[model samples]
Target: MSIIAFSIAKIYSDSALNDENTFEETEKKFDKINNNDGIFEYKSDGFYLKQNKTREYIKWIEIESVIYFDYHILKNVNSTGIEISTSHKIYKIHNNDERSMGIEKFENELNKNINKNELYDSEVLSDGSSKTPLYIKSKI
Candidate 1:
């Protein structure tokens, strides 16, 4: 059973879980990482997304990739995040939209314990994609 915790209620099955709009809102709302109100201790068994607060598990196999990134345009609300893309939804976790030094910490936490060979190492995936030690698409 796949469960997504949008709140204390609103749990959906994995088969019924890909509503783009809802996921987008969930992403945008939870973009920043604040200890009092954000995701932490993220881990996977190569198949699920486990973290705090929600206690909902997103299967990783359902995810196409996790694009961890940080960018700013004219310092307009500095945005830094990991875009979790699945076959039908995108979940954004903006690590530090309010600050400048937290992106690195967010990233380090994101890649913690995951092997280097398990994710997309290059900034861009070439026309010829390289295979990861683990068959999952995660780029940093």
Candidate 2:
């Protein structure tokens, strides 16, 4: 167990996950959590989620899990923001109501893509366990 000097979340522009190949050319932005790619799409080949143009292609199959947490604040949150948990790291995505892009829209799209890809939503157990491909709501 050494140490990870830079393990911050990679922000996307939503376009990073348009359909799949449509976003292969999307430049992966980095630099102290710069908001880059939008939305998140899974390509048969791979997807980009980093802060570098040279190395940000991530294979879809490589993704072991995806946790969507958009419950920030009803008013404070500009539309919506979510964190995608992957095997490597967590990616941060923020969207606003501009251009008809809001939290509700993004959330629905995210779910559609997940189901289309045949992914399994993990469930976070009360014992502190975890899982999701679908979506786990509040715990009470």
Candidate 3:
């Protein structure tokens, strides 16, 4: 059984930005336990259930602030994969199609605050590639 606690839930409510929305609803939190036989045991708030018995796709009742782990995020980015670095640790955002929009939204927020011109020189990288960093706009 693997347990992961995320700061927020990435919900896919739109398709224009690739069908995703990151909502900061903090009411439901739970753990997903997976058995060896490909059965998933979801435990949270006095709810215990099993999935993946008959079919590969399993659906559950929607909760206020719970998001499932999507593995497709890591697959579509590149062969080397997408590596996200935070202040605490490095995370490999895997490929889970549902979560793609949320991740991209978060990245956009971070990129907006970065000042590429001030941080790095105008020279290209060792691979002869130069990409400008993202700059975020402030509200105030």
lDDT of 1 at 72: 46
| Candidate topping TM-score | 1
Ranking by lDDT: 1, 2, 3
Candidate 3 TM-score over all chains jointly: 0.25
lDDT of 2 by residue, 41-137 (tens): 3355655443323335555454444454334343354223455555676655554433222334445544544434455554555544343344422
Supply candidate 1's per-residue lDDT for 67: 68
Candidate 1, lDDT over the whole model: 0.47
lDDT tens per residue, model 1, 27-74: 654554332223433445432333333444555456565665545434
Judged by lDDT relative to the true structure, which candidate is superior, 1 or 2?
1
**Clashes in candidate 1: how many?**
2
Give the root-mean-square deviation of each candidate in angstroms. 18.3, 19.0, 18.8
**Each model's total of backbone clashes:** 2, 21, 13
Off by over 4 Å in 1: 1-56, 97-140
Best-performing candidate as measured by lDDT: 1
Task: Name the regions of candidate 2 deviating beyond 4 angstroms.
Answer: 1-43, 50-55, 74-79, 97-140
